[model samples]
Structures are given as C-alpha cells and as structure tokens.
Target: MIEHKPLRLLRHLAWIPAIWIAWELLHYEQYKLLGNPGSVFLFTVLTDWLGFHGYEKAMRLGVGAMEIAASILVLIPRTQGFGGLFAMGVMSGAIFFHTVSPLGIDPYSDGGVLFKEACLTWAAGLLVAVLRRDQLVALFNRIAGRDAAVPA
Candidate 1:
C-alpha cells in the first residue's frame, strides 16, 4: 500500500500549528491567572459590557483554566484535534467580544496586537483541527455509538 507523499508531509507538519496554539494559550496563562493589568483591564471592560460587572475575576479564572486544559490537550498527539476545537471555541468568544464590545480592536492601544493574535491563534487552531480531522471523526463516531472503522 502506497501512502500519498503530500498527506505524509502534512501529517508531519501538523505539529507546527498544534504547537502554536498550545504556546499561545500557555503563554497567556500568566496574564489571565495572575491579574496582569492588561488582562484585568480587558476582562473588566468585557464583563462590564456584558453586564457581568464584578464577575471579571471569575471569568478570567475560568478562561485561564480552559486555556490550560486546551494547551495540555494540544500538546498530546492523540488529543490535538480536541484541543484545537477547544481553542477555536474560546477564541471565537474572544473575537466576538473584541469586535462587538467597547473593547474594540485596539483596547490597549497596542496596535491591535491582542486582536491580531486572537485571529492568528484561531486560524492556527482551525489548521490543527483540520489536520487531525481523522481523530475528530473517530471520536465523534465513538460518541455516536458507531464503529469508527466503518465509513459513514
């Protein structure tokens, strides 16, 4: 049985996006968890806009926890797709909030760095998820009580 060379190369290259997603998530952990002024300001503005008011701490901690989980999953070869999906979900919320809320694209006046990173991270997560779609399909099959080995 001959394997397609492009597919083989893609399989190897999949790690690049996986690592990027993981690194981005893990890198932001300190800001979210440790109450960095920038993170605090962002979350405060977001919570205020959402009418969550004083729940900024909870939101920040919750997001930080999820990021930690996603990063760990992304670092594992077998669970990379799940992690990517997790990242996409989280980043989707971030992108939405950034665009719709008063936060705007350049909340910190840092030239929209945060917004751009979120977009790039979302794309990276998507790439990783697509690359590991086989695992996603198998997982879905298992959840749906179908045989993963059988074609749908």
Candidate 2:
C-alpha cells in the first residue's frame, strides 16, 4: 500500500491556493490586454452558462470563492478525492473556454497566454492524477480481476 504522509500531502495541497492566486494575478488585466470585444463576448457566454445574468460582479466573486473552497476541500484527506474531481471540472471548463474563444486566435498574438492556460490545465489534471493514484490503481485492479474471472 502506498503511504501518504501528512507533510507530503500538505505540501501538494499548498500548490492549489498558490497556483490559483498566481493565475488570478497574472490574468488580472486579461480582459483589457486581450481586448474589450473579446472580454464582453466571453463574459456573456459565462453568464449564460452559469445562469448568473444581471449580477456580473457578484458572479465573479462567487466563482473565485468556489475555486478557493474547492482547493481547500482537496487539501483535506477525507474530501480530497471529490475535491480533485471538482477542480478537474473547473480546469476543464477553463481550457474549453480558452479554446473556443478569441483567446485561441493565435498562440503568439496574446503573449502566449493561451499556452499558459493550456499548461495550467495539464498541471491540474496531473495533480489530480497524482493525488488519486491509489484509487485509480484499485479501480484498475478490480476491473482486471473481473476480466480474469469471466469465462472465455
């Protein structure tokens, strides 16, 4: 059995908040830097998808809080698995948004912002995989045993 030490787990957990803060800081001026047209278009899409129209300011704040809560949940041993899954969904949505927006116009156009987003998406997936490796292994074992027990 793979042993997860508390210190090691905490170290990995620390990356969750650290990374989110870094991303927010780095992209604080994303709407302005990328252009207002694109910003308005993306925001509209977000509002429609999240059903948070007429309260854009509150929506943004809520999203940030949700991200923080998810990260914190992922740090707790008992909730880490579910939290990781939630984080993965959030990251995946981010990746999809970037891909389908003007953000994907050109890799070189936005100072490699799309590239950074892609990297972050992959990082989130990798982190979740690492944190849940034992669960994944167990799942695989169960499937493999079932296959072996079946008659040809």
**How many backbone collisions does model 1 have?**
0
lDDT of 1 at 142: 83
lDDT for 95 (candidate 1): 93
- Which one wins on lDDT? 1
What digit string (tens of lDDT, one per residue) describes model 2 on residues 65-120? 55566666555554454455665665666577657654353434667674476456
Candidate 1 lDDT over 50-148, as tens digits, reads 899999999999999998898888778778788889999889988999899999989878899888998998998898889878778898998899877
TM-score of 1: 0.92
All candidates: TM-score: 0.92, 0.48
Output candidate 2 Cα RMSD. 8.9
Error of 2 at 79 (Å): 2.3
lDDT of model 2, residue 61: 51
